[model samples]
Target: MTLLLLLDDPAQPGVVELQSLTDDGLPEGSVSVAADDLASAVREREADRPRWVWDDTSRRYPPLLAAGVRVERCHDLRLCHAILRRSVYSQSSTLAGAPPGPWDGPREPPPVEGSLFDDVGPSVVADPLAELREQLAAVAGADEPGRLRLLLAAESTGALIAAEMQRDGMPWSVETHDALLVSLLGERPRSGRPPKLEALADEVRAALGQPSLNLDSQPDLLRGLRAAGCDVESTRTWEIKALEHPVRDPLLAYKKLSRLLSANGWAWMEAWVHDGRFRPDYVPGGVVTGRWATSGGGALQLPASIRAAVRADPGWKLVVADAAQLEPRVLAAMSGDTAMAAAGRKADLYQGVVDAGIVETRSEAKYAMLGAIYGATTGPSAVLMPRLTRAYPHAVALVEAGARAGERGDVVSTWLGRTSPRPDAAWQAEHAAASAEGAGADDVRAARRRGRDWGRFTRNFIVQGTAAEWALCWMASLRRRLLELDGRPHLVFFLHDEVMVHAPAEVADEVAVAMRSSAVEAGRLLFGATPVEFALNVAVVDSYDQAK
Candidate 1:
């Protein structure tokens, strides 16, 4: 029997009211109980393994997880509604046909200290049970309800993982982080800049022959560089490196130190790191391609130098697993390209292409394949594009079709169903203006530029979005597999194509096996009976720095 958890204030004043929902979202089986004691109610229901239907997983699951309660399944209405409404498969559904409502509002951040996942007022719902009915109708109306339902399930599971990872923060080491900073940029001084940064600034000033020039200021530095006749277009690292002047070295050093100081400096350490762990605000489905983005602390962009701080607790080990050549394998599976699938069987997909004699070197194969997917029209990649097309026609043609559709301003859906948004009004207007009679040269050029950009975005979107779906399934499967064990291994961190589990030393091997097994399961679930293999490189270490 499934339990429908309605978070309402009036339904049972200051408590959760549990109701039994029928397939059509009607009240059924008159055993409705007001769960004043939420954890116990949840614990009892968890043992029954009922699918808890709720509004938001991020809002509801954290408290249960924190209270040592776990559930087998959930139906996150908000997340499912979002997926269903935008999916091309559900275009004929009522939810997709109607105007956006409160459910469309930006998700509230998970409560920090307030009533944890508490019920909302009557006005907030606007009849939530009916809303669930509408969402179910949408799922039923989808062209491929099975795939869309699978997507929603995977997305909701991701929400649960995101919240749990936040609660159980990633293992971090302040001592090691501080030491790395000291080694690279010197000790944290009482005031002003670090010693290495200060020394670099001094060298830069001497080289520029301006003892007091403000290197921190971009305009002032550009003027100083111009005065010294150092051929620099901008303060970009690539631009600076091309210079032959002595300022290049110190300026590079200054930029590196500046980035470090600004992004992950002492202030950052104090703010982000707490109790030997870094808990980041993870926003799942934040990116258009379904990739997870972080709210703060640069969780998605942790620098390699700062990774020394990600140490496991004593007697614990970090099992890091990253999907190897994820996008290429996704392409092979989706395109049903046996040649491409065979090439991706090796650890290095590009090298395999080189061995197949499709390209001269691994680099050529890499650039060509990436360029094809990304809509490159010129340069090294474009030059090698024909060879790759001849070698792997289907994989190349798949992206080419996506690119063509994007150029025509048509929306394209991913493997499961997340659809690319149609061109906005402004974009359509601009494109129309370019098509109008007697359009200016500048207008035509601007329209062409926009076309290329959107084409590139759409070209990459399919593969990236499918890869994200695969990742969601991978992590969800791993979560279930890990939970099946005696609750020892815990997932502490997750990036796009990687996951790090904090487990006991004795279970490290088991975690590695689970990671690989989960990959196989995810692949099978997405593309059954396909020849493509979603390979992963697994590493077990005491610190995150040890993993690639």
Candidate 2:
């Protein structure tokens, strides 16, 4: 008997038919169709041509759609044939996706819930803009145009905060900002020197209606001044004194602290800015595998007091973007473990793995899996290994093999050129000697020696070093793309895995698009035909912490 299946227009959507033919060459199921069913039927009665017909018992039918349409009998046969064809002809699936198109609108970050600024008391919130305007007016009233020291001071503080935020992944919360202000102005002794400082103090004290004050106790004074506006508290115990001050009223003290901190931050920033502008230096080839490095001035650090000065240049704004969960995604693609890859494609890879029955819980799966790949042994891995071994035997086996090789003191290399160096001769000798011992106490020695012989260290070097290369390429690509934009925004800061550019405000959106495009490009450049992808977060702000 022969079986035949017919499908609708291969080029368009339609129906399917199945047929079976008896050994005697008679159609056994349904009506029999001629070899050229569509052509013959059309010739006899053009309008009555049947789209599909079949004999289920004999399993024979006329061709539907085109002859090139796929044909098979049993389900297994079809699947096997499809797999073979794909394996032979399809390109490797590790390539990155296409670059993003030009941005059409603003790419502002969504408002963060529970920002650092939330800690600031209600006084500033009552009318922050009004308070700022009033303070600006008072300082402007005392000084001539261009010589407005208070404005300069505020600008400087903003710059410092921006720098610090870039360096550390810290939050720019209100409490931290207040603490930074206190730290900056806490202990400047009143030297009656720097005439501008003394003059500024007098003006501020007058504004707050207080007696001449000692600036050394600036934190206490700042508290009192904020209290006058109905917001005051000693958030930092180290800055407070139990004894009442005899020199200045609390309001004057607070005013002095706020002014001094703002002013001092400005002065420090002025010194840090080389030549004329506060252009921070960036290190492109910083990490071992291609990540960034930090040079002089800790350009990445943005202490809160200094962030206010990081205002967008007049008519320009800052736009920032960062990747989300990049490393695990890379791992999922590299291993080609279908189960792991499927889990990753759905959502957070680590969390997905836990839900997919890979481990008892999310934390256990993450710790064990990450530990296995990253060579984390003593801590979380100890608790995580058994579950991982049970769930992902193939993926875990690869890592275990690498770990064993590392113990044996062998070198391992990634697809790229980076390599983990081989172990020293002393370690090799111990393994060799242990191999010669017989079973007993000597057996323990042999086991320990064999453990060391496996390439545990080398395995990690291969994975981490390669991962670093990917990060480097990602940063490099982003830097190049940013440079290509119309305006020549300076590439001011880089930490391993992140790049910070200072560009004009109008082109901020363009810069963000460039960043996204560059990440995709970098992935393609490194992985070639392998399937790879990326996600990014963008923000516009005066400081790095706010960028998050």
RMSD in Å for all candidates: 2.0, 28.6
Tens-place lDDT digits, model 2, residues 411-472: 55543433344556766676666666463667557657566445555555555655555654
lDDT of 1 at 350: 85
What's the lDDT of the predicted structure labeled candidate 1? 0.85
Candidate 1 residue 32 Cα shift, in angstroms, is: 7.2
Each model's TM-score? 0.95, 0.47
Residue 44 local lDDT, model 2? 38
Highest TM-score against the true fold, candidate = 1
Off by over 4 Å in 2: 1-181, 188-292, 295-312, 354-365, 378-380, 389-394, 429-456
Weakest 10 consecutive residues of candidate 1 by summed lDDT? 114-123
Q: Pick the candidate with the highest lDDT.
A: 1
